[model samples]
Target chain A: MLGRLNHVAIAVRDAEKAAKIYGAAFGAEISAPLPLPEHGVITVFAILPNTKIEFIQPLGETSPIAKFVERNADGGIHHVCYEVPDIVATRDILIAEGARVLGDGEPKIGAHGKPVLFFHPKDFSGALVEIEQS
Target chain B: MLGRLNHVAIAVRDAEKAAKIYGAAFGAEISAPLPLPEHGVITVFAILPNTKIEFIQPLGETSPIAKFVERNADGGIHHVCYEVPDIVATRDILIAEGARVLGDGEPKIGAHGKPVLFFHPKDFSGALVEIEQS
Candidate 1:
């Protein structure tokens, strides 16, 4: 079963500005900004009482986030992540259902320091989804 | 503080198809399709272990969801809802921080039967956010 809504991620040209908006408006406690070169993104987590909002900004010219921001211009919600009790099982089941898992078809250590898998947006209609081990 | 990630909503042309996909892939329990005429949408909640994934379909020609689907063609993630301890207080605080709360600037009974408020997408950097009283 899906454990919980892990985090909702937004792709922005400037995540600091987005984080500031959440901080100033909702008084959200935001994390120190983190840069993941391998992921080609800079990330920050706006911690809420029960969940998190992730602000993602492109760290390189060819980052997928950069392309998203380019298409949306004003930026937009990038993806939503869900926590799963067993990500590997989740992956196997999703694969059996004819869904395409992105990347190398294996779990990778994500920003949360947990095994995570990404599903193709097409598989979920349009929303990109991430499943993380809880 | 925002209480929890209430639900991640997706606007779809066919919520049933989406629900079926989730049901098949994750074996999730889905609510009966609910039509909210006032909101001009049909909604179904895929119950997970800790959070909900809401699938929304336009019920009218002029629905904002219809327009979103038109623009996106394939539909996409629409908005995210967060639970708050007090909806009115959250509204006031957001206003004080110069964020525009949509509609009448007052809380209304939402689909969850809780007081809720919608924030302008621009204010939150293109993410439409809903704050619902927990």
Candidate 2:
């Protein structure tokens, strides 16, 4: 089942400047930038008391974030991650309900170092959904 | 300062169908559809343990949701709402920090019957951020 929301990922061209807004405006603590070559994005976590805002910038031209930015020049909210007790079971449930899981239908290691899987945007009202192991 | 994330609003063509996925897949509780004609959107709240996912559908063509749907076709995550202790103070802080507050720079009575204001997406790394009075 879906647990608490882990974080909302926003795709941006400049993750640092974006993180600065949260840090300066809301006084949120910010994590040092982390690069995930496997995911092809650099992430900075803007920590709030309740949840985090993950700013993701494209690592390379081939990165998905780059493609997303090309389509949405201003960059925008990319995907939302929600915690799940058992990601495998959650994936099964979603599959059974006709939701198309992104990638190879297998959980991959996400930025949080947890097993996570993404659902197709079309099945989620055009909003990409990620379920991460809690 | 920004408090916890209150909810993420998704603009969808059909709020009921969008809410159904959370209900069926995650067994999440869903609120009855409520029409907010003033905002020109019909809304349904999908209750999660940590926060709510708000599904919004356009009540009329003039609605902002309708315009978003026109551009996106399938609809998508429209904006994210974060709770704040003092919206006026938050607005002042954002303005002082060079963030553009959307609309007339005054808090409006939002769907939750609390004062709320939106920050421009361009200023927020492409994600429209709403700060609502807690």
Candidate 3:
């Protein structure tokens, strides 16, 4: 299930440069750079008109985003985040539909102080889908 | 530069099923589906919280989104669309910064009836960025 799009995550090699490119190109204002310790990465949020584009860079070599960049050979579209009213119900529905839940445990505090869970790409075609309750 | 995120485009193998998956899960109302003969694909738009997530399936083999889904071996995040105040100025800035322009010729009417241009992934890392002026 999906709600409104909360944010579109983009994996960038250099968050600063990427932010600049986006800032100059689209006049997106950099809200703040946040450290997502649980995800092992630091991210910058550029607030655009109706949505926020997240610029994510891995803090460590073993970080999942870093590995993804390596696999894709560059930073690309990372994930599409949907704002759901209820995270638990959404997770249950997806799980029942044979979707692979990357986190069956809990919704951790994500970059924007929202509870977020990621669905594995294996279950949802080729895209990593994030469900956030706010 | 950006007015608002017009839509978040997700490449899916089956637009109908993806629409169902998202619809049943998030209670998203499926808007009228549209086909862009110029883009060579049929797409369904599901409007959610405050934004829209587009489920796109290519109509032919030569479509860019079609080729992308094939390269990734699965449907995934296709591109992020940013609404710009002036498409011409935005294009000039990216070009001045050595960004590779995928379509330098002209802005074609995209699926949503807006003039759109695509920026090559080579210039901006691994993501295809589209700019539309409403």
Candidate 4:
């Protein structure tokens, strides 16, 4: 079952620059950008009380978010990650409900080092959703 | 100062149908659709532990989100709302930081019956941000 609303990821051209307002105006603590070459993204986190806002930029030419940033230009909400007690079980349930899991239907080690799976946007009414093992 | 992330609003064609996956697959509590003609939207809430996911549909032809739904046929993440201790102060600070506040730059009574203000997406790296009084 779904647990906490983990974090919302925003695709941007510059992760750190995109998070500056959260630190300067909202007074939220922002983490320094960290590159994950395997994931092809550089991420910056704006730590909030109950959740976090993740700003992600492309780490390489083949980055998964590269097309998203190109399409959005100014950047946009890329996906929402939710915590699940059992990701594999959750994926099976979602598949049974006619949801399409992205990427060969296997949970991958996500940005938070948890097993995670992403669902296709079309099946979820145009919102890409990620389920992370809690 | 910014507090919790209140909710993420997703613009969809049908609020009830859009929230079905959360209830059926994620086992999340989904609220009955509530029409706010004044705001020109019919909203259904998928209650998560840390925050809520709001599914909104246009109420009438002149609804504000009509254009968004038109642009994104499958629906999409519309805005992210964050809670603030003092909305007025927060708005002033955001403005002083060169962020463009949407509309008249004044806090309006939001769907939750609390003062809220929206920032232009361009100013927030292409993501519409809402700040509500906590």
Candidate 5:
């Protein structure tokens, strides 16, 4: 079962710049931009009271979110991640319930260094969803 | 200053139906659909451990999210709501920092019966942001 609403990922052209207002106006703690070449993203986290807002920028030519950023142009909420006690069990239930998992239906190390799997947006009412092992 | 993230609003055609997966798969508590005619929306809340995922359906022809749903076709994140201690003060700070508040630059009673103000997506990395009074 789901544990907590882990984080919301936003795709932007500049992760650190996009998180500036959160720090300057909202007083949220903004983390330094960290580029993960494997994930093809540069992540900047805005630490909120209950959860985190992750600002992600495409890192390379083949970045997965590059197209999303180009299409949105102004950046947008890319996905919402939820924590699960057992991601494998959660994935099994989701698959049994007819939800399509992205990327070979296997869990991969996610941005948070935890096992994570993504569900197809079409299955989740048009919103991209990520489930991470807590 | 900002408080906890109030909720993430996902615009969908069917509020209750869209939240079914959260209840069935994630074991999240799903609330009965509440129609807010004044706000032109019908809402179903999926209660998570740390926050809520609000599924909103347009109630009327003039509903604000009607166009968004039509454009997305598959439902997508409409906006993210964050709580603030003093909305007025927060608004002033955001304005001073060159963030454009949506509409006539005034706070309105939100779906939760709290004062809420929306910011233009252009000012916030193309993602619509809502600030609600805590």
Candidate 6:
């Protein structure tokens, strides 16, 4: 159903600053910072040895990520993404089993050029999880 | 530094039920249910094809995870755990860089016999992250 964890999404106030802080702490350098216009967030990818930690911040106040950070009081884990071989199949199965899809249609290209879709937090406890395929 | 993502921890009100729901939705089976007394939580491991999702529920109301669930108003992604080769070195480095350690002192044996320690969410945004060495 799922593949390896593509990346763990971390919400931050500033992507560049957070990347620098984390890079200094973990002894790793940031890969590249990309702006996700559709999601209304800018993200910096910090590729660790085995896992990639993404630092995300809203581009503007109207961004959904910004709204999420505001609601949570501080930035937190926005979503956990797992790589899946087939996004449509997995999404269909989950929806059939009563899991709600946050996205309206099929999976779309997400950060890192992978197809991704989100499952509502209500369906899987309170964690907003994303399923992606590389 | 890190090996791979051992698992992603999800806090739930009912581990067993959550396991069943996820199992049905993902077409995966519950590997085994384990009781972690020190964390004051019981967990059931749901191994998916490429990733393992852990369902954790507090044994009692006083449990830290229970308190987290309550504070969040619903169960959410509690912590993200990455498998590391050296928990001690990682803990020391993070602490030296002004990261707070939620667990006192050294890493201890966790649910799966791996030594684990938690870094305070304040240091890494708002997500409680656990590092484990198996």
How displaced is residue B62 in candidate 6, in Å?
A: 3.6
Chain B TM-scores, listed for every candidate in order, come to 0.93, 0.97, 0.88, 0.98, 0.98, 0.87
| Candidate 2 lDDT over residue span B1-134, tens digit each | 76999999999888998899899999899999999999899999998887889999999768877778888777799999999999998899899999999889989999889999999988887889999999
lDDT per residue, candidate 1, A1-134, as tens digits?
A: 65677888999888888899677766789888899988889998899766788999999877868778988777799888988888999999899988899999889998768999999887887989899999
State the interface C-alpha RMSD of candidate 1: 1.7
Error of 4 at A79 (Å): 0.5
Q: Which residue segments of model 3 deviate by more than 4 Å?
A: none
Query: Candidate 6 versus the native: TM-score?
Result: 0.88
Candidate 2, TM-score vs. the true structure?
Answer: 0.96
Candidate 2 residue-wise lDDT, A1-134, digit = tens: 77988999999887887799888989888988888888899999998777889999999667877988787777799999999999999999999999999889989888889999999999999999999999
- Badly placed stretches (over 4 Å) of model 2 are none
lDDT of 4 by residue, B58-86 (tens): 99989989999999899999999999999
State residue A123's C-alpha deviation in candidate 4, in Å.
1.1
lDDT (Cα, 0-100) at A5 in candidate 4:
90
CAPRI-style grade of the A/B interface in model 4: high
TM-score preference between candidates 1 and 6, better one: 1
Kindly give the number of clashing pairs for every candidate.
0, 0, 3, 0, 0, 1
lDDT of 5 by residue, A1-134 (tens): 77889999999999999999999999999999999999999999999999999999999899999999999998999999999999999999999888999989889999889999999999999889999999
Please identify which of the two predictions, 2 or 4, would achieve the higher lDDT against the true structure.
4
TM-score of 1: 0.92
Best by DockQ: 4
- Per-model TM values vs. the true structure: 0.92, 0.96, 0.91, 0.99, 0.98, 0.88
The 0-to-1 C-alpha lDDT of every candidate, in the order given, reads 0.85, 0.89, 0.77, 0.94, 0.94, 0.77
Better of 1 and 2 by TM-score: 2
lDDT of 2 at B12: 85
